[model samples]
Target: MTKDELKQRICESVDRRRSQIEGIGDQIMVNPELGFKEFETAKLVANTMEEFGFQTETGLARTGVKAVLKGKNPGPTVALIGELDSLGVADHPMVNPETGAAHACGHNAQIAGLMGAMMAIADTQAGEELAGNVVFLAVPAEEYVEVEFRRDLVKGGEITLLGGKCELIKQGHFDDIDVAMMIHTHSDSTMKKTGVSTSSNGFVSKLIRFVGRAAHSGGSPHLGINALNAAQIAINAMHAQRETFRDSDAIRVHPIITKGGDIVNVVPAEVTMETYVRGRTKEAILDANAKVDRALRAGAMAVGAKVEIETLPGYMPLANDATMVDMFEQNSEELFGEDELTKVGHRTGSTDMGDVSHLIPAIHPMMAGASGPGHSRDWHISDKEMGYLGPAKSLAMMAVDLLYGDAEGAKAVMENHDPLMSKEEYLAFQEGVFRTEVYDGETGTSEVES
Candidate 1:
């Protein structure tokens, strides 16, 4: 059997089960689960994988699902990933009643698309003609949940990292995989496209704490050094530095004062704040964080108070492997037609996938699934035009391309691959970045340092 024939066969097989795949998406949308807490969602996806005859592993990276399917012959191993967690978009019309979570980010669609590919390839009679191995992965916590919560999980031995796919990579879950593909569904246009980010921002998470003396507001206001006041001062300083931030690197520093103080009547003794330092490059992120730290310390000095900072390496910027992206583009056009596969436009977002991209050759593509603004309450799936099916088909076809498409595609992707930093080098950089002096929940003094 020819590669084109095999591709056609897989698409047809998945097309026949379109209804089942759509049902899976709808079910997950209705029962949305938050990042790192996708118990039911994981089970649902895992069950489907098992039905397809893939040997599965559960509880990876804390509630992740992994399945491996061996081909008729040994070749390169290609992996397809579907994120299993939803965002905390509570007001969304499709919010799950029990969990108060919603699929506003279109993760449900991603899962369904992954399922379609897994099932189709598993049932493909052309496996004898295909090359290498295929692995379908369902990852948890791609959402990058807060550091403190994730740290707790790590401390309790539930998991050792924050970002879902990063945790998996660290756990040797994908050590043998030669290629990785992630399809993120957005509620944008009708196009099915793949995007290559020349540069993506890295994130440094911090918890800021401020300490001050508390006294009755009305009776002894003069005796108190309001920690809340100090926090506001620190935030003001951060805002003022916006002008100094280099726009070329897309440096972004946003902070939220999570806890101002106790009762308003009494001068609060402590205030805690959470913040993210983002930049197009790790150096830019680190530089911006250094300025942030200086501001926090300045605030503490002005108020005659002390500040504490706790930091963690959130994620690294995503840099596409040139060869991998070129291969994806060619395969996309072949399976979906030139019209269907296009480049993304005016989009800016970050992902833990960046972490993997740093370690190995990877591709993250954007596919449309709905209309209107994405990541908002107004985000809704438009099933009329098979908006959902087109993207799902595109993703399934991408897998087919990687596993069975002309060997030239895989060869090109592999040839152009280069690691920005070695595993040891990257780990050393992260260890140096995830440093902090203080971490108090009440005082907003934690800051990501250079």
Candidate 2:
């Protein structure tokens, strides 16, 4: 069959499984789980992939899952990825009361669309006419959260990196994959139905703690050193550095105090905080991160308290492959028209996909299917057709266009693309970013963690 004919058959197959596809998306929406611990979600994804006759692997990077569909001939390998974790949005309507995990960012749709593509590709037997393999990856922990728990896991040697994709890459899960692609749900009403940015911001995380002497709140309060006061001052200092940040760098620093005190009647002796210093480039992120560290130390110095800061490598700046972006746009236009193909130049948010983009040609685009700001309680899937079925047919068709016959499309992408870093360099840089230090306010001394 011709390439176009194969694509048409794939789309038809996706349409035939519309109910099942939508059900998968809806079912996940209610059963949301957090990153690196998505056992329930992994089970569901693995079972679905196995039923479709794909060779599946589970328990990767804690809770990641993957499956491969090989073509009649051997050539380049393409990865279709989906995040299998949710964020904490306690007030969301679909939140899990037991865990406070909610699908507020529309990750549920990513997996749903991924499954739809898998179903269509397999049902149509498109691999028979192709010259490459399709790898379906359900990765965990795209959202860099639960810092304390993840840090403990790292210290325990249960995992090395905090982000799921970073850990997967460290474990060489993507070694065989030639290219990768994933779609995120867009909540901005101003954006078109779909879009792809040329690039996006990267970030590094800081886990902070302020130590002070405790005292009875209603008694001799003068005997207490207020740790909360130090935390507040540090937040203000971080804000003060914002004006110094270059607009071209697109710097963003947002910190939240995770703990205040033990009891309302007692003066708090310890305060813990977490934040990410995000920017468009590695230099920019590091520059801003250093300034944040200085500000945290300033807080402790002023209060005569102690401060501990732990720095963790977050993600690399996303540089989407130009050729891959064009192919995705072309296939999306063919399937859903060009009206929703908005030209998104650069995004401020970050994702682990950026890490993969550094080592191979990768694309992380967006499709309009939800309303309300992402990660907010109001965020949810609004258009089932465009949200669920849109990516389904688009991904399947893109794969057909890339791997059909001699696989010229996939070949051109790899040939024209230049990776930002080798796998070894990427691993070394990420590992170097992990460190901890303590500053003693009274002694004006700092000690680095071994």
Candidate 3:
């Protein structure tokens, strides 16, 4: 069959299962689960893949699900990804009270759209005409929250890396995939029905703690070193460094105090804080991270307190493959229409897909379907057609365009794409970011590997 004919058949099949697709999205929205803990969501994805005669694998990187649809002959493997975890928005109407998890980021729509594409391709039996495999990936833990819990998981030997895609890469999950693509549902009004960006930022997470001797506030305030004061000093110092950050790097450092003290009546002996240092490039992120760490140490030194800083690896900067993006843009116009695609500049936000992009050719485009501020209580899929079926058609059409005939489209994309980092290099860089340093202010001493 012609490429357009195959895409048409897949789109028809997706349209036929419109109601089912909508239901899946809606059901998942109200029962959201947090990252690494997305058991139910993973189960649903695995069952759905099984229904389409694809033997699925679960428990990948804790709650990831993966299945492949083999074509008539293999040329290049393309991954169509869907994030399985939800943001922790306790106040959201559709939130799961037990988990404080909500689909406020439109991850539910991602899964629904992904399943729609998978169903359409499977239902139409387009694999016979295609030349490469299609990998449907339901990845978990895209949102980098619950850092403490994730750290505990790491210490327990449950998982080494934090982000789902990062951990999966460490586990060798993407070894067979040549290219990766996923559509993120956006609630922004400025976006068109579809949008692609040149790049996005990456980040590293820090868990900081200040320790001091506790003493009665009223009786012996002079005897106790206030940890809260140290934390406040660190925050202000970080703000001061903001002026030094280069605007071209798009550096961002925002810290929050997770714990102040045990009781207000006593001098604060412990203060815990968390922050993410994000930037458009790895070098920028590391530079900002070092400045933040210096500020933390300065704060502890000023107050004669002890500061413990733990740095963990986050996502890498995203570099969307040019050829793959061109293919997606073309398929989007053919499926939706011309004059509807949106071209955007580099984004400052971070995602695990960035890590995958550094390892292989990848695209993380946004599809306009949801409404309301992202990760907020009011965010939801506002347009069923655009939110549910648009991605389905767009993703499937892109796959068809790439895998049809001898798969020249996929070949061209791979030929033109040069991965930003080798797998070993990426892994080493991330592992190197893992560190713990304890600075004692009283003796002016800090211990680390240097």
Candidate 4:
């Protein structure tokens, strides 16, 4: 069969399983679980993959599941990835009341689309006509939340990295796959039915603490040192550096104070803050991070308080593979028409997929099916056909295009691609980002190490 014929068959197959696919998506949406805690979701994916006759592996990166569908011929291995996590949007209509987990980011759609593609390809035996293997992966903790909990996990040696993909890379889960693709749901109505971005920002996570002497607020205010004041100074200093950030770098730094004080009567002894420094390139992100650190130290120095700063590795900047983008674009246009396709430029947001794109050929595109601002309580899947089936058909078609006919398409993508970093270099760089520092103003002493 020709490539188009195979794609048609796959789409027809997906259509035949429309109810099942939508059911899976709806089920996941209503039962949302937070990152690193998606046991039920992972179980669902594993069971579905097993039902479809794929070899399954579970408990990867804590809650990830992987299943492989081997082709008749030996060639490249391509992975179709779906994130298995949700955000802590307590106000969302579909949020899990107890856990405050909600599928505000539309990851449920990603899983559904992944399963839809799997059902279509397996049911039609498309692998028999292809030259490469296909892997279905449901990964965990893409949102990068619950920092304190994740840090506790690290301290206990339960995991080394906060992001799921980062941990998976450290555990060698992605080592076997040569090419990867995943579709994310977007909320922008101005965009077409489907869109592909050229690149996106990456970020480094930070946790900060300010310590000072506590005393009576009414009688002996002079005996107390205000940690909250130091935090305020630090925030102002961070704002002062905004003018120095280059527009071309697309830098973003937003910090929030998690704890301000303990009581109304006593002087606060400790204050805490969390933030991320995001930029379009590694150099830019590191430069901004240094500025932030200096500002934090300045705050401590001004108030004669001690400050401890913890830095953790976050997602890397995403650079989509040009050849993979072309194949995805073609398939998108074929399914949704050229007018319904949009080409996006650089996005300011970040994803762990960006980390994957740096080491191998990968594409992270967006499909429209939802309404309201992304990650907001109002966000939801309004168009099931476009939300669930559009990506299903697009991914299935792209799989056929890449793996069919001696795997020429996959080879071309790899040939045209040059990785930003090797696996060793990538691991070293991320590990180096893990550091902690304590600066004491009164003693004029500092402790810094990575």
Candidate 5:
């Protein structure tokens, strides 16, 4: 069959399983789970893959699930990925009452689309005509929430990295795959039907604590130091550094005080804050991070308190593969017309797919089937057909285009692509970001540091 004919067959197959795909998506939306703890979602994905006659594996990078579909000939491998995690949005209508977890970012749609692609490719027997393999990945913990919990997981050697894709890379999961793609749902109405950004930001996660002497607020107040004042100073200092950031770098630093004080009657002795320093490039992110550290130290020095800062590796900056983008764009345009497609520039948000893009050819595109702001309580899948089926057809069609007839499209992508870093280099860079420092303001020196 011709490439177009194969695409038609795949789309028809996806339509045939539309109800099942939507059911899975709705189930995940209502039963949201947090990062690294998506056991229920993982089970659903595994069962679905198994039912479709694919070899499935679970417990990857904690709660990740992988399914493989072998092609007719041994060639390059392609991956269709979906994130299986939700954010802590207690106010969302579909949020879990106990855990406060909600799929406000449309991850449920990603899983649904992934399953739809799998059904289409497998049921239509499209793999029999392709020269490369296809992999369906349901990864966990893309939101980077519950920092302390994830830090403990890292300390206990349960996970090497916070992001699921990064840990999977460390575990050698993507070593076999040569190309990858994933569709994220967007809330932008101006974007029409579909969109793809050229790049996005990377970040470093930080946890800060300020320590001071506590005493009775009504008596002996002079002997006490207020850590909340130090935190306020630190936040102000961080704001002061904003003017120095280069416009092209797209630096963003937003911090929130998690713990302000213990009691109202006593002078607060402990204050904690959490934030992410995001930038367009790794160097930019590091530069902004250093400024933040200096500001934090300044606050401690001013208040005569000690400060502990812990920095963790977050997602890398995404650079979509040009060749892969071209292939996917072609499929999208064919499916939804040229006017429905839009090309986006740099986006300040980040994703774990950036880590995968650094090593292999990848594309993280957006499909508009949702309404309202992303990660907000109002966000939801507004158009079921566009939300679930659009991505399904786009991913499957791109796979056929790349893997058909001796895999010329895939080879062209590999030939033109140059990785920013090798897998070893990437791991070393991320591991190096892990650091802890305790600076004593009174002594004007580092103490009890790690």
Candidate 6:
């Protein structure tokens, strides 16, 4: 079959499974499991993969599911990833009854899309003609949340790392893969589209604990070393450093005081803070982290408080393979109308796919799903027709084109790839760069149970 024929076949396949896929999305949306805890969600996807004849592996990177479809002959291997986690956004009507998780991030749609694409690839005749492989990965814990909970997971060895894809990468999940492609949902009027960005921010998280002496608040306030005061001072210092960060670098530093001592009248003995430092480049993030460390230490010293810093490494900056973008753009134009492919500027978000991109050539495109702002509660997949089918079609078409289409399709994408380092070199660089300190929540400053 020609590339066009395979594309049509895949589109038809997705259409055939539209109702089934939408049902899966609805079930996940209603259940709304949070990051690293997507047990049901993972089961649903893995079961689907097994039914479709893809070789499956579970418990990889702790709740992540990996399935691979090999062609008759070996060629380039491309991976399609689906995130299986949701955000803790408040006020969602379809909230999970027990866990309070909501699929505000529209990852349910992503999984359905991946499943649809996997089905098409499994049923495609191109497998006999093309010498390549397709990988379907349903990753858990992409959304970094509840630092204390994930930190405990790291400590218990349930997972080697925090973020799902990053942990998978560290486990050499993508070592055999060559190219990776996945579509994310964005709130836009257009039914389905592609987003390309030159760069994205690298992020790091830290939990800072301040220890001070407690004393009577009203009677002997002088005897108390105020930990809250130190926290306030640190926040103020972070705000002061904001202007120094370049706009192009897109530096974001936000901190929350998780614990501010016990009683209002009693002098606070201990305080804990959770903070994030994000920047457009790794170098910028590292530099900003150093400055943040200095300011936080200064704040603690001024209040006679001893401070402890525990840092969690996050996703590296996303560098989209331009070659892959071009191939995707051409393929998208062929599948949808030429107008379906639109230019999107840089977005201020992070993903574990960034880690995969660092390992091999990768493309992460944003597909339009809703009409309002992205990641906002107002953001929703109201138009199920467009929201469900469009993402599935785009992802399926990209896979078919890359795997079955003439080498020209894959060649265009590989030509524009700006790979800074080889896969081995990149892995080495990441090993040296990314580090996270796991802390037991039971021994937390304020004693929050793990």
Query: What would the per-residue lDDT of candidate 5 be over residues 60-87, giving only the tens digit for each residue?
Result: 9999999988889988899999999999
TM-score of model number 5: 0.99
Model-by-model lDDT, in order? Answer: 0.75, 0.91, 0.91, 0.93, 0.93, 0.76
lDDT of 3 by residue, 1-450 (tens): 788788888888999999999999998998899999999989988998899899998999999999999999978998999999999998998888888999988889899999999999999998999899999999999999999999899999999899999999999999999989999998778877889999999999999999998999999999999999999999999999999999989898889999999998899999999999999999999999999999999899989999999999999988898898888888778877897778888888999999999988899988888888998988989998989898888888888878889989889888998888999999999999999999998888988741
Between prediction 2 and prediction 6, which has the larger lDDT?
2
Clashes of 3: 0
The local lDDT score (0 to 100) that residue 200 gets in candidate 1 is 69
How many steric clashes does model 4 contain?
0
Spell out the clash pairs found in candidate 2.
none
TM-score of 1: 0.91
Model 6 has a clash total of 3
Q: Give the residue spans of candidate 2 off by over 4 A.
A: none
Residue 62 of model 5: what lDDT?
91
Taking the tens digit of each residue's C-alpha lDDT, what string does model 1 give over 128-232? 665677678899988765567787886698776678987787788878888788777665554554444455677888888888899999999899878888888
Per-candidate RMSD, Å: 3.2, 1.1, 1.0, 0.8, 0.9, 4.3
lDDT (C-alpha) at residue 278 in model 4: 99
Report lDDT (Cα) of residue 278, candidate 6.
Answer: 91
Clashing pairs in 3: none
Q: Report how far off residue 274 is in candidate 2 (Å).
A: 0.6
| TM-score of each model, in listed order | 0.91, 0.98, 0.98, 0.99, 0.99, 0.91
lDDT at 265, model 6? 96
